[model samples]
Target: GAGVSQSPRYKVAKRGQDVALRCDPISGHVSLFWYQQALGQGPEFLTYFQNEAQLDKSGLPSDRFFAERPEGSVSTLKIQRTQQEDSAVYLCASSTDRGSVADTQYFGPGTRLTVL
Candidate 1:
């Protein structure tokens, strides 16, 4: 892929169900980030990874949310015990910079997860 790509572009999950979202970043990008965007609101940072090491996860809303970037290029965001509040678009982005705060990120189309 020339840019970031995400799997399961759209997902519908019943309450209590678990879901995993996949993200494949551009080759050689060293920084990856996960964000959650609610209706009419901007994306909120969820986590960040530099290479295969998770450097920040303080923005994750709860323990039910987890993200990993093993081997550095591919990442996954998992939400366990889904709730209605979890309904939102999960976005994955990558940057060529080494996890710098000012890095310009290229985003994927995102996976829209709807919880019922």
Candidate 2:
């Protein structure tokens, strides 16, 4: 892809339902990241992947959240038993530099999840 792309720009899920959001990063990007942005707040890093390796997942709120980048190009974020507190905009970003402080990430428009 030319840029980061995310699917289902908007999603509405029942309180206990599960949902999957997808991301397609730019071609040849070495680093992929997932972030959660609550309304009126800055995006919070959820996980990071360097190629096929999941290097960090310290920011995931709970075990109910899972993310994977199998081929190091496309990624998925699955949230199980969604809660009202889980409603937020899920963003995917990619960079050519992996875990470098100077890396500039290009972000997707995001999937806006609304749990009711």
Candidate 3:
């Protein structure tokens, strides 16, 4: 019963560079989500995937951001041309079901990205 976990708990990137962060969701979970959290703000959904299908990605801020959950398990979030404005905590969450508000998502500690 491994919970979701993210890599690099912290990252520092120069503007214009690209970075890839990883996430490992709990085994057998069917839903996964990515979110961005800014200082003093609540986590905002970036995208969500049900199994290998990306069910929603309307919250991704720009084309520079991409995500995937190919195996219906682990997922990755990649940001290109990093901007100082992108500095924030990237969080990952997972649940047992999809398309239900009743699903309780468990979140990882998050990767704190700081763009310089």
Candidate 4:
């Protein structure tokens, strides 16, 4: 079965640098979510998208961070003016909206970002 996957599994950046992380979800999944996990901390929800519409984004830490789902299947998270504290694992999870499908989310291998 196909699953979610991320790109550039690792990243290094200087403070104030900008970076983009990509997530490719399983085809036909109707709901998508983004989460951030800091070192030694549980993942924190960042945003949620249903189809191509952004249903929730209250968890975004700052205006400098942004996410998009222009095609409903692939999404990107962008962080600008990055600080060392911004280092974390960015995770993408997706679930289907069909009946009989358990509301279980399949998570992607996260993209690790480090700001120096």
Model 2 Cα RMSD, 1 decimal: 1.4
Candidate 2 residue 103 C-alpha distance from true site, Å: 1.5
Ranking by TM-score: 3, 2, 1, 4
| TM-score for predicted model 2 compared with the true structure | 0.95
Selected candidate, larger lDDT, 1 vs 4: 1
Cα lDDT of all candidates, in order? 0.94, 0.95, 0.95, 0.93
RMSD of each: 1.4, 1.4, 1.2, 1.6
Q: After superposition, how far is residue 114 of candidate 1 from its true place, in Å?
A: 0.3
Ranked by lDDT, the better of candidates 1 and 3 is 3
Q: Estimate, for each residue in 26-112, the C-alpha lDDT of model 3 and write its tens digit.
A: 988899999999999999999999999998999999999999998898999999999999999999999999656799999999999
Error of 2 at 94 (Å): 0.1
Candidate 4 accuracy as lDDT: 0.93
The 10-residue segment with the lowest total lDDT in model 3: 94-103
Ranking by lDDT: 3, 2, 1, 4
Show the lowest summed lDDT stretch of 10 residues, model 2. 96-105
Q: For candidate 2, lDDT tens digit of each residue in 1-116?
A: 37899998999999999999999999999999999999999999999999999999999999999999998889999999999999999999999986468899999999999999
